[model samples]
Each structure stands twice: as structure tokens, then as C-alpha cells.
Target: MPTREDPLVSFKFGLEIEGKLTGFFTQVSGIGSESEVIQHKVVNSETGETIMQQIPGRLTWTPVTLKRGVTSSMDIWEWRQQVVEGKIGEARTNCSIVAYAQDNTEIARWNFENAWPSKVVGPEMDAGSTNYMIEDVTIVHEGVERVS
Candidate 1:
């Protein structure tokens, strides 16, 4: 019999860029993939009725977005600048997001390949209001998989 384990908390996770621990993020989303549905119509042999069948087409990966408090590091911005400057080929790199258990033991790791920042947004400014300066960067990748 297999022993049950509590679900790992996502709050304590880290993002690694090019195999190095980058920084802490408040939120990370868009970790998914979808297939394009292809429809085809066929005729029933006996009833001669038209029937539609759904077929899975090309697979598309969702862009992963990372959000965090703005810090002194300009790495994320520099990475995005590569895309903006038409140097995307140089921007592509393998990255990983690691989830940890309560005691900070590594629980799960999501590895992505050929990832490049597609979008990066800086925090909005308001003089009278006080809020943590946040920034978000969305990365598009060829594929992602969870390995251990």
C-alpha cells in the first residue's frame, strides 16, 4: 500500500533561470496546454446521417507569467529586452520552477525548454498610495513537463 502525503504548498516555491535560483514571486500562472480541435463531417453507412467528429489538432502551450516585487535585479528586464531588440534567439533558455514542502524540501519541479520572455510589465506609480512595487513577466516556451 502506498502512503498518503499532504499536498505541497505553492506559496513556498522558487523560479530558476538558466539553472540558477532567480528570485521570489508573489504569483505564477498560465501553466497549461491545449490542443486545437478539428471537426470533420462523415456520413453514417446505414442511416446516411451526417455525423461530426472531433479530432485533436496542433498542441499549443500556454505562456507562463511570473509576478514579484520589483527589486534591484535587472535580469528579467534584460531578458525581455532581448525579445524587444529582435534578439529572441539569444533570449531562449531552459528554466524551472520548483515547489517545496513545509520544511523547504524539494517537492516538485517544472522544467520548461526554449523559454523566452514574451511580455514584461512594470508597476504602476501612485504618489499618494503605498503598495509594493510589482512587476510581471510572461514567458513562452516550446514545452514544459514536471519531473519529480
Candidate 2:
């Protein structure tokens, strides 16, 4: 008999910076990368058949977006300010995205290096609606690794 694999659910996750908990965000996205494809033509000496070969050129990392309910915390805002003031060198740091299992135990983790916020969008205001306000922060990083 073969055993079945149980996939971990993604609803429970948090962000951490330098081993400090940033927050358990409402949504996280864009944890991915792409490789540039280079095609080359190879001619066969005997058959004269041309073959198109695809090789990877460069790797491009995608920007990760984090979203959460609006709170009094100003950490994300302050981090973005550093970039706005041309202090990007100070802004870059390592952070981790941690995913938890059903019992709230960390099941997986992805770490980002040289990370900084590229954009921060505040929640929209509406006096008539009684919904929780959400803010978004987009971050770009030089590299990423799965720690566990």
C-alpha cells in the first residue's frame, strides 16, 4: 500500500524580520521566479537537421506582496520611508515568510535576502462601509531560499 501525502494549508502564516515577528498577514503572494530562455539553432553535420535548443540565460525574482488589516503599527511605513529618502542601503535586510499548520506549528519557511519595500499602499477610506481596512506592501528581493 502506498502512503498519501497531506499538503499543508496556507491560511495561517506570518512574516518575520531578524527573528522578530512582523505580523500574521491576511494574504501573501508572488513568491516565485522566472528564468530567461535562450534559443539556439544547432545544425547536424550528417543529416542537416536544425535543432532549436532552449537554454536558461538569467533568473529574475518576482516581487512579493503582503497584505493585512490596517493597524496602529508604523513599522512597514517607516521601512518604506527609508527607501523614499534615498536610504535604500539601510532598508535592505533579510526576512522570512513562515507558514503554520493546523495546530499553529510552523510547517514551512521561505527566507528573503536583501529585501526592501518597493511600494506601500494604504487602505481606502469609506465612511459608509463597516469593513476592516487593509493595506498592501510590495517587496523585491535579490534572493530567496527555503530554510525548512
Candidate 3:
């Protein structure tokens, strides 16, 4: 028999984009993939009953959103700018979301293929409030797979 263990915590993870360290991110969401289904009807000859059968259809990966406090680097913004300028092909790259253990060792990794920045949002400024400036970016990818 196998021994049971507790699942990994969510916060101890990291993000890497095209082999570049993305630094610390406050939030990472929308890491999902889904497939559509096609349905068909089948009829029973003797009982005169109908049944619906489903078949797998197209697959789609949801856009991933990454949020973090403002930094001096403009790498995320530069990637988005390329998209806005109709240079999508040059902007597409691979990304990895890695899970780290308590000892800071990489235990698992999810690799996203052909990813590109779809949108970028800047931090909001308020004169009366004091908070860390946060920026967010949305990334679209063709597929996502667990590599480890």
C-alpha cells in the first residue's frame, strides 16, 4: 500500500517566461485547459429508445493572468507592445509555471507552448492612497502540459 501525504501549498510557486525569470508574482490565475464535446443521437431498434452519445471536439487553453508589484523591468510591457504592433509571431514564446517545495526545490512544472501576451494592464495611481503599484498581464497559449 502507498502512504498518503498532504498536497502542496499554492503560494510556493514561481513563473518563468521564455527562460527569463519573471520574479515574484502576487497572483497567478486562469491556468486551465478545456475541450468541447460533440454529441450524437442513437436509437434502439426494439425498445424504440433514443440515447445521446458524446465525442471529443476541439481543445482550448484559457488565458493565464499574472499579477505582481511594479518593477523597473519593462519586459512584460515590451512583449505586449509587440502584439499591438502586429508582430505576434515574433512575440510568441514558451512559459513555465513551476511548483516549489518547502526547501525551494522545483517539484513540478507546467509548460505552456506558443504563448504570447494578449493584454497588459498598468497599475492605477491614487494620490490619497499608499500601496504598492501592481501590474498585470494576460497570456494566451496554444496548449499546456505537465512536464514534471
lDDT of 1 by residue, 51-109 (tens): 99999999999999888999999999988899999998899999998877667788889
Q: Residues 1-148, candidate 2, lDDT per residue (tens digit)?
A: 8999797687777888878998888788999889999999999999999999999999999999999998898999999999999999999999999998778889899999999999999999999999999999999999999887
- Is candidate 2 or 3 superior in TM-score? 2
State the C-alpha lDDT per candidate: 0.89, 0.92, 0.86
Query: What is the lDDT ranking, best to worst?
Result: 2, 1, 3
Every model's TM-score: 0.89, 0.94, 0.89
Q: Scored by Cα lDDT, where does model 3 land?
A: 0.86
Candidate 1, residue 4: CA error in Å? 3.8
Error of 2 at 146 (Å): 1.7
Where in model 3 is the C-alpha error above 4 Å?
Answer: none
> Which segments of model 1 are wrong by more than 4 Å?
1-5
Clashing pairs in 2: none
Q: Which model is ahead, 2 or 3, in terms of lDDT?
A: 2
List RMSD in Å for every model shown.
1.8, 1.2, 1.7
In model 2, the number of clashes is 0
